[model samples]
Target: MSNDILRLNIPPEEPNLDPNTVCKTYPELSQEQYSLCFEHPDVTASAIQGIQVAIHECQHQLKEYRWNCSSLEKKNKNPHASPLLERGYKETAFAYAISAAGVTHQVAKACSLGKLKSCGCDMSLHGKIRQKWEWGGCSHNVEFGEDFSKKFLDSKERKARDIHGRINIHNNRAGRLAVIKNVNRQCKCHGMSGSCELRTCWKATPEFREVGKRLRRKYEKARKVDILNKATARYRRIRKQTRRTELVYYERSPNYCDPNPLVDSPGTSGRLCNKTSDGVDNCETLCCGRGYNTLRVRRTERCDCKFHWCCYVVCQTCHYNEWVTVCK
Candidate 1:
């Protein structure tokens, strides 16, 4: 993952551009990935969407923490070029995992929605006889997502012959595993009116927030590992001891309290914080003890609404002022 696939481009205006047109269209994707993009444009769009989901979820999960995923939001600059991803810190581990999981979730859900020609409903469950429940509904084709992610997302990291590359690959797989683990088993009754004799079941994608929560927990307990060669005895022992679902890191995180040019971290200066709580989002912790400033701000929103007999509802605009805290 030297570069971010978030930069993958296929301009809407140029619908008939040549596949070999300057390579700028897919500067981030490998040859194989871009090749598929030319054939399956829908999949490429879905991949981008998956990354967007990952970014949104990442921001949501880290909203109250330092290094709150704001680097992925730099305008005009390549967001993937953020230093947040270059190191083997716990945040990097979570980034790789969540991005991979996001791709899996979107791709699988796309299959169920008939959005791709190459993939469709997962028939693996359709004919299976598992006790009382029969596979009936369209199950998410996670296998397709896993394969696409491996081919597309894993392409770059597979070329690197270093430990960081290995870390990215591991975290990527861990993220996909997180999505797979959260796949829900949905069932419906197929028996007589009031009798419970048989049931219909389908595998569905669980809420992406659940995946984020699981990865956040793993980030809290991420393990540090150092191994250059899989042929060595220590590597074997560590691999044997560590579960694949767990996140692994190689280096300690940077001081996120202050701006670090090396890692492109923006200090928490002026960031909103909760002054009344003793938590990660509190001014003391988030501001790095630099104190904070209080300000009264007013904002407006739709307030009271009333529905007419056969028409739309009317609402009144309301403005209110509230005191806010910002890191100094």
Candidate 2:
């Protein structure tokens, strides 16, 4: 594989990957897995979309948090260097969840887009099959997506029996489950004389943002698990006691406010913060007892609008000053 292939393996990279030659792009993946990625042309597209969706959704989900998921770029570039991987932090859970969800969302969409030759829109609905209603819309083929994601993403942890390995597998599956659970039926009513006699419904996939939101909720409620004899049944029992939908971790996250290059902490210095709110964006709490600086910012906007003539309207430009806060 070439540098392009290596660069395209993870998210935040340009999504200009060629669909036909994706498998050859990732030399890190096992030969068997590499071949599997190209087993069908649709897999290529889905795989690319998966990486993009994971990073984009994760960044959006953590936009307000102190760390803001920016550590993902480094983690993706060097998986072993990631602090999240070494410790079961909330950030680690988010990473696993977003990556799995991305693959799940893309595979389902690719199936509906006619990219997958083996499966099209879902036709297993009882109403459509029984002729109670017409299947006039494309359904998200979540079944295929879930299966494919399991086979592909889980393969990464196949040889590992460590606690981190097990946690990764669990989190990844949780992400996939979030996507499958969010699939809903979207229907349209149709009948002669506008009567409510028949309907056509299709399984629709939720926006990737919804999946991210669900995972974020899981991250908040993530459980700390103990690795007791990871090779024995006791470990399985302990892990099984936790809810499968909840993200499982082994350690608490570090205080990300301080600069710690060893763990990829960028620190909150110079970070923009909101002075008007008490949320995560609040300057005081985000700066971790470190003082902040307030600056007067000038801004312009279209302030006044007036109707003109028959079809047009115009607005007047206005200037305003606002106070902005930043971590010092």
Q: Which candidate gets the maximum lDDT versus the true structure?
A: 1
Error of 1 at 310 (Å): 34
Stretches of candidate 2 above 4 Å error?
A: 1-20, 26-32, 73-83, 126-136, 193-196, 228-234, 296-323
lDDT of 2 by residue, 74-184 (tens): 322523245655566778877877788877888787778775666787767634443556666888888888877777767756666666667788888899889988888
Local distance difference test, per candidate? Answer: 0.74, 0.69
Task: Provide the TM-score for each candidate, comma-separated.
Answer: 0.81, 0.78
RMSD of each: 7.3, 8.5
- Candidate 2 — worst ten consecutive residues by lDDT sum? 304-313
Among residues 3 or more apart in sequence or in different chains, the pairs in candidate 2 whose N, CA or C atoms overlap within 3 Å are none
Quick one: best TM-score, which candidate?
1
Poorest 10 consecutive residues of model 1 by lDDT? 305-314
Please state the error at residue 195 of candidate 1 in Å.
Answer: 6.9
Give one digit per residue, the lDDT tens place, for model 1 in 40-142: 6666556655765687688888989988887775433434456777777888888889889988988888878886767998998697878887888899999
CA lDDT, candidate 1, residue 67: 81
